[model samples]
Target: MTGEPGGAATDAMQFWDERYVSRRTEHGRIWSGDVNSTVEQQLKGLPPGSALELGSGEGADALWLAAQGWNVTALDISSVALAVGAAEATKEGLSDRIEWVQTDLATWRPSAQYDLVMSAFLHSPVEFPREAVLRRAVSAVAPGGSLLIVGHGGFPPMSEHAHGTDFPSFPSPDDVLASLHLPSGWAVETNALIERTAKWRDEQDVVLVDTVLRVRRDE
Candidate 1:
């Protein structure tokens, strides 16, 4: 959701903290106040269960999943972001259904397997151990569980920020799947590029290309 230099010590955490704090000051919330369309659509047929969300900024997806009867643990690097999300969940009477944790995905190891493990738009500005983190995420999926990952396929028109500037090149669906190295009994449900129209600042509409991957671990 926010981007800054990630190479220096504590830079990633500080960068996210500052971004969320500034967003809270300016907009009160950093992202759109709705569940991501890709997530919503992908989870439509799946039954609710224990879910883990990495980089769950503002908890939109986590809150939505909890409302759909899934117990969720949402992790983010920014305390400000998690605080805002927690307050929102409390206000919605869904606080009991979700657990919020603050940790860097690069180093955090999964303590429990989950029925659903997901990360949406988890691109980082600084060089991150993307492959390693994803591999670990895959390992956290319980048998018969699902893993959903959505990422920016490319920048939209009229955007000032270009690829390889704030972040590295967005990984293709195949790239992500290959990095996971999924073992036998894992089935690829969806691995493709899709397009969605996004409203920037709730003003202009920009068509964003997204790489979506969904996999199911066989029972």
Candidate 2:
């Protein structure tokens, strides 16, 4: 597979694809189904609108957003994961509410703006072509819209993470914002690392350090 971000050593798409193909049983859900406590807490009381979920593995958050009255677009590089997400949406009778796209962020172009743009666990162990990914996500946001980014903080220590996994080390929220290199008009709402338990298939009792940010673009 072509490695856009992180280069030849570990092409994320290939690595994830292999993991999907080799899995013997379900990997158990890794994210909470509840409106994503971090995103919800930061966005509480905020009005809803169109949303886009990046690296939307299995679509748990996307499905939840659709239920919340947001028009949602969920994208992922893994067709296996996308298929599973689509099946879940069908089961929930929400197939009509979500637009699922299979595209590689390494080269995919943003088609339109969204009220909220989100990235959850789209971390990579190696340094990614950070500018490309961040710019793409930011460009997808409409003016007056919000951008939310959540990633595992380097807590629970990188040692606790599964070996050989392609997960990325967490950057501080400020660093993430800086990397986005957003145009002059975007306003920062929140940027910090929030500690919380990952209410999913977490087994190691590891505390989840999430780098969370919420930014609003000027109209």
Candidate 3:
């Protein structure tokens, strides 16, 4: 559920919980149980370490990372989503490798630093303090660690989104970099726009532009 739309202007927990719970009765899962393409492309083959994911929908990325020997903290607003991830983790015997945390990112702060901090497609249809939350994650990155943020640059073809007031016009990679306000010790690693095919409404395939940014703090 990296980029899925679940609006919650007042109660994010209830809205997202219902979104996952109701949908699970129809579709087994909202998203494919696989690592995000951006995460796989950017982090594959790197040494396993502590990782934190801000919007860990059903824990696909978390499971994938744990399978690769990385300890992961998967956080989400909905307890239902976390339960799904935890169930899958136990079934796969990866429960010990991952910790599921249910909390709203707006008020929750990381108590410990991670070697990798991820905020993959942390978007919502409702108004959110996204930049402020991202700023909170900056100080949680350990020395020599990296922060990776991926976002939707545009909607898939033939999809409902029109980049209008209705849909969220996701930020660009440059906007993310500017918002971070990292100090001099940080170095930009990869900041580029990538094109990839994505599923629209779980059926149609369309190409989409992805905003990708990865920055590392000096050791």
Candidate 4:
């Protein structure tokens, strides 16, 4: 992945790198070791094929996709995070099933289309053109393929982590859908906010809202 030399772009990269490094040092893993619930629920019963995952932190979703028979290309901006995920994949005997790529999505271009493109919780604190990236992701979808994007709708009422950060505004389902500007033959399979219970600090179950958008390119 490549981008402009300076300004917010550089800051974004450094911010993510530091964040991942800290996570690796403190927690050993940043995200849950399981595939994202939105991904699992959306992909269930669908035929597996080529998949590209953006911001594939810790490779949980990618590993799960590979285990289900989809060849996966997992891309992330953080090498520290990728290394941790790579090690986990190797331990699970899934090393050959995934290609771990270190890339900045701000400028990374897809060389080929995929049957599925997924981005879960791809929020960033730095300045980034997320909509442009999402447009590129949609362009990389082959006909009859699908794109799934899930993001935090808002912080849970009981949250502590997101209390003091300048978290970017979470996009609504309509906001994400409108950004795609999909042409004819494309279908909006899912566009809504869904709530799920999550374990927070192993103390209590917290209800979190997810803004989910799934679109399919018609055959």
Best by lDDT: 1
lDDT score, residue 61, model 3?
A: 90
> TM-score order of candidates, best first?
1, 3, 4, 2
Against the true structure, what is each candidate's TM-score? 0.91, 0.81, 0.91, 0.90
lDDT agreement with native, every candidate: 0.86, 0.74, 0.85, 0.85
Using lDDT as the measure, what is the rank order of every candidate, best first? 1, 4, 3, 2
What are the per-residue Cα lDDT tens digits for candidate 3 across 1-219? 222234442377777888987877354677778788887898888788999999899999999999999999998987788888999999999999999987778776779999999988898765578999999999989999999999888776676566446765778999999999988899998899998876766567878788999999996
* Candidate 4 residue lDDT tens string, 1-219: 333446655666678778876765345876668887877888988899999999998889999999998999999887767888899989999888889987788887889999999999888766678889998898889999999999999987776655756565688999999998888889999999998878776558888899999999996
Model 1 weakest lDDT span, ten residues long: 1-10
Is 3 or 4 the stronger prediction by TM-score?
3
What are the runs in model 4 whose C-alpha is more than 4 Å off?
A: 1-10, 25-27, 160-168
Worst 10 residues of 3 by lDDT: 1-10
Q: Which pairs of residues collide in model 1?
A: none
RMSD of each: 3.6, 4.5, 4.0, 2.6
Assess candidate 3 and give its lDDT: 0.85
Off by over 4 Å in 1: 1-9, 25-27, 163-167
Q: Count the backbone clashes (under 3 Å) in each candidate.
A: 0, 4, 0, 0
